[model samples]
Target: MQETGSADPFSLSGVIPPTITAFDEDEAVDYDRTAAHARYVVDGGAHGVFPLGTNGEFPLLSGEERDGVVEAVVEEIDDVPVIAGVGAPSTHQTVRHAEHAESVGADGIVVVTPYYYPLDHDAALEHYRTVAESVDLPLYVYHIPSKTGNALSLDTLDALADIENLVGVKDSSKDVPWLAQAIDAHPDLTFLAGSDSLLFPGLEIGCSGMVSAVANVFPELVVDLFEAYEEGDEDRARDLQSEVYDVRDAIKYGSYMAGVKSALPHAGFDAGPLRSPLRLMDEEDEEAMVADLEALDLL
Candidate 1:
């Protein structure tokens, strides 16, 4: 299979973590902590660092805030590709964000489907097509239906695979069969699993790699699983895959990004609170995370 990013040295393969955006007490963007977190994950073994994704709280950030986060991570990400999240409600916004990400030296951009208003297949196709055309960098289709309410059918994905700039996709839909089918159908397209739960099954189904949120807490483990799978060590891959789900469940404790952000403090990185409207973890939640980490021996 001609994996989407195979031609480029900065291929979007292996364990890529959508890094959390740290904030200060006043909920202001903390570039220093954000950059440190990026460095932490890369040093921990992430092949790529994604900023301003769902875990990074993109929808809640302002123009300056999001751009700062992207630039900060780009500065710290030395060799690994900084695939910045530039999804927005409109094509205009998405295009501008993609342009800005490119301006700040992001290796590529991941654009989610237009949310808030449901679009039919043709509308969705046109939207993605326009964004890919507007930017010079490689674009990845973020097929996360649960949040966006816009799931691309396998047929739509088939069409997208032909686009010159549409290089890869991250499947968060949780449909293993669909992901496998997409991978088989578009042998050249880069198929990346979106959640930690899909890590093992996705690779089994021929996915090139994954964009795991839990990789924030344990990058080495995620990288180990990918290496095991690539080396044909199914048993070791299964073991690491199981460990990742435990980490994923632990971080999914509080509301939205709170779990991951809260869990980072124990790993020696104090990822600040979630943005407004997204509540922080309470003391009880903290205790649960502590217990979970203790059980996992990650503490």
Candidate 2:
């Protein structure tokens, strides 16, 4: 599972969602079902698939379960790179996960900034530096301020830019100006917008692409936007952006995964319930999402 120094799959740049790991009624990882979903996504048109990410409920899964999910995804996906999400509160444990991912043949490791304890810019930089040095494979710095409370400051990114193993980043902060700043600071580094709706805006600001959650439900829509933008079809791209805005308004808020998972059973996918402590959608919320999807003919 060691990702050698062949080519950096960490050079992420597209609508690649950290996929939702589907489980059966018994709350077990549905490897066959999930792998089929992975194939569905690759065929639907996405640059890659990320397993064991925040959306995949990384914290809820045991290390062995995480490895199983990664292995299943890698097996299903053809050329689509699988960037394994290996973030944790402990740096040592995070590095261990990263090394495990590398050992399991993952294309790259997506390490989110450690949360719980508020670490300053230097400490944040050092945490990433330590993980990057721990493995020879490329690293993708995941910056989600709302979740981690440890934002990747412009100064910190500037410092980490010098690390050879740190190839790119997926910024989920939703701070467009800050994302722009990261692109400005490191013109060579890959800056992927973690927000699906911001793909066009990120691209306009020189961002390579996105690590979107919506792509799990609407891969073709996001991929269409990227294709249109690349083809210089601004009108088509703008229309896709409008679709994202509408979809985000419907399902991106509150228990987003539950909303999406609720929609899945309707879409002919047997997506089971969410794990405990995280409840599934209530009647009212489920109705709203279904209505939205129905309006779009997605359900």
Candidate 3:
């Protein structure tokens, strides 16, 4: 594991899959299915398992459900760290989530910027500082402005990297130059590109890993891609990276999150249904995705 210092034991490096949280027909959290999928990814060679991120429908879950999901994941997996998502709209809630994650045995916590209400640089800085102080666990800031509507300037990110116990960030901003800037500025901090489409480009610069939604369908694909890139197999890395984009493109043809949820069952996981307001792919589109998976020999 790569460490920033003696205080940092958990490395947020390698192809970490932000796994899906399964639900039953009633939309309740299905812990067994969720844990099974977590184990599946680990057995498929994921460096770590990230549950309840955007792809896991974190915003859709209640705090209690979040607790249960993290607990299930930790108990079910073997040998890899579990970085649980503790993103909330408020700092207090985020702190609570982080505390609960630690209490339930999560190896680390990922805190996305507070959503809905945009904050100035100072407020955002204080927000992370407060949460970091509340927990002893290693923390990774999740910088995904598209969903959270709060972007972290390079200065803000540098400041966060300086915070005690805040070790790294997963940049979903999809801005390669900006991510490159963060990597260059904080050489001690780990930077993970949050999109599969940018995986090759990010690695070409200095990203240590990825937090990919598409990894839900093929954990091995992302793992292989990361391995190929790390081993200096440029041709294999490029080919695998291209394959990731193909699957990601298929998933995005439908609702971004829903497309992933829909693919789980086809991939042999029991992902019940997409939570409300997130519709499933239409029959035709579903067939197309299945076809895409078939073409990739993923099914």
Candidate 4:
């Protein structure tokens, strides 16, 4: 981790991919395939690449393997900020991962709130505080209530914002009003929209950018939305936004990573199927996804 002084850790710019992690046919972490996916997205125009994020199957990998992936991606990326996602149910493990990320060349760390069991306000605060204090690098609080069973409440955020190293947040909910209010209340805080379909409306308020899983397959589309908006081309921005929205709808029908992985090969990359318990789609579902992509001429 870069030495954190008074510098702001919140960097909200560009198309950042919560990139897809690939596994070989034997179900091992395919570093080459993972790096290839990262390169493909970056080459397609992503500002940076985030690995081991939720979309990258963070929960599915072992702790040691997670570190390996972070190290490999950092080595491969060279200059792009490789925001490593490092959070766990336990405070000690979370800190350990954060320290490991620091030892490597990770640009930042993304911490998800403890899940599997509900956390009260105090517990959540302590959980984040411990992790934040363990490293000198920027820490991004991940707020995805749908999967975590807990939202990063305003009260919790207020406390976290006080942490010297606490940089920003990645809000995955579709709640733009609440996110805008949060960004307004904390002007120093960098807010990243985690949903691609919400990117245009999000920037209209105060969100810096997005950490989109859809960028795994369509990085240019997401980046264009950001660029057009910045260039004052609202019409072009809306057009790109609509295209990604249509693709987003297709991925939501089933496992998103699985759907995207299936499309990757069609897009001319061999992103194999997902791990166990997250099986490849049945033939019918696969056909449905193909039909949707074909409709958009993406296939």
Candidate 5:
């Protein structure tokens, strides 16, 4: 088994938001607001920060913009670990991002599965192997099949476990059986539940932490849930989980992935606008969402 020390970056636990990339009104990346948001979550008790993940609009931003966001967050956060997302469709591009993340002093890197192309197990192993070999930092495999269209099977995971620097996985698969089985099968690799809906269940099943999108706007709620669980207050943790479900439902009132950006202003920070191709909530939807949040006393 690959032993992970308590001081290792892979020991990351608790709530880590896949932070949203703030953009100006004209849709340019806003580094100031973006870094401020990172500081907000870390100050609110997030264990770490993950910039340029799905919520951060990684695919929408150019490579330069992505590096800028990482640099800004790394510069702002001195206490918490920053695990920048460096996944791309090809091995070449993914390596470049991973190298840049290391160059900028990011604590770790999360590489999502290669997407857009259907890959065989051999191809998948090679892709991860090449990237893992290119960097010295801890590497966490990002398995979000719904978005990536490429899934990592347990057999392939077994192969990946042999890579020296490959330390953990952040699974957004939402398949409890798969997650549980993988956890059971690979005691050497740490697992993080990447979906908000499965936070409690994931903890129950052995996920060391969570990557909650809802944490972007409501870090305390998620952090409280994690702390409650860690402190052995299961009742409070369950209650918080129920509250998270309600918040999640309310956020879905708008377009896909727009809730966090829209709800930011209500939470006292304006992440500006999301890039094109993803729109914000309309007036009616925004009002309804605000009403729900108000009812929950989140506003």
Candidate 6:
């Protein structure tokens, strides 16, 4: 809502990485390395950077830590949009996070739907309306039902599109039909594909951009894919999509959300360890992942 950056915050196109939050061996937030990772992706030709999202381990971080990560990323990357994730189980907490992001100069705020407690359509609409009105920055609804347990129905999206300052939706649902329909229904709202698996299909179906976790490690690969499609080279784009599929499989080894952090070392970045309860890859699994990357000539 606040106009603080040079880049058009609503121009949320191209490849944007949901960057990982770097932690030390002690599992504490490392602000320096966390900012460095944001710089690394932008340097790799990523169009924008999204911190404190799923890959950043937002659920495990304290509100203060989340604010710190946003400040670090906003300071480190001046040219691209930095859309910080500020969603919580409650609207009150989400508004606080959104306010902090705007104050710290984040170009926009991504609010994942309130999780844990199931809500009806009216409750969901009011929740988003409140968050959108609370901030002056562009607000993008993050629809990742698998993790949040609250899926946004098409009818709900229809209502959301009418909210002022509610600019876009990031769909990680992986339900292509649903995503395609949502995009078709709301041409005014920017739609970003939130899964690497749907990057090409998303673009083909009129997605403005992508929020890829794989880009956190191998950004150039994702960037190349996006560029190819934009340049009208369908063959090249499809080829890159195949390559991305391989990369996704290789990096997805071990526990959930662990592959990206574990594979960072191979990409010349150290995102440290996953916070407690989310274990890193074991020796055996890591070696296999390395071999998979090597087989794909990505190592």
Tell me, by lDDT, which candidate is best: 5
| Model 6 residue pairs with clashes | 1-136, 1-137
Global fold similarity of model 3 (TM-score): 0.96
TM-score of each: 0.96, 0.92, 0.96, 0.94, 0.97, 0.96
Off by over 4 Å in 1: 1-9
Residue pairs with backbone atoms closer than 3 Å in model 5 (clashes): none
lDDT per residue as tens, model 1, 1-299: 23455523355689889888888898998999999998999999888888888889899999888899999999888778889999998999998999999998999999988898987878888888999898889888888989998888988887777778888888899988888788888767678889889898888776778898888888888999999988889999999999987887887777876777788888878888888899778889888988998899988
Candidate closest to the true structure, highest TM-score: 5
Candidate achieving higher lDDT, 3 or 4: 3
Clashes of 1: 0
Model 4 residue runs over 4 Å out of place are 1-10
**Alpha-carbon error at 230 in model 5, in Å?**
0.6
What lDDT does candidate 6 reach at residue 152?
A: 89
Candidate 4 lDDT tens digits, 1-299: 11122235445577789987889897788888888888899888988888877878889899988988888788889657778889887889899999999999888899988778888889988888889888888898888888888887787788888988888888887778788778877867777788876888877777777888778888877888889988889899888889898988776656645677777777788877687778776677777877898899877
lDDT of 1 at 118: 89
Better of 3 and 5 by lDDT: 5
Off by over 4 Å in 2: 1-11, 252-256
Q: How many residue pairs clash in each candidate?
A: 0, 6, 0, 1, 0, 2
Kindly give the stretch of ten consecutive residues in candidate 2 with the minimal lDDT sum.
Answer: 1-10
Which is better, 2 or 6, measured by lDDT?
A: 6
Poorly placed runs, candidate 5 (over 4 Å) = 1-9
Q: How far is 104's C-alpha from truth in model 2 (Å)? A: 1.1
Write down the lDDT that model 1 would get: 0.85
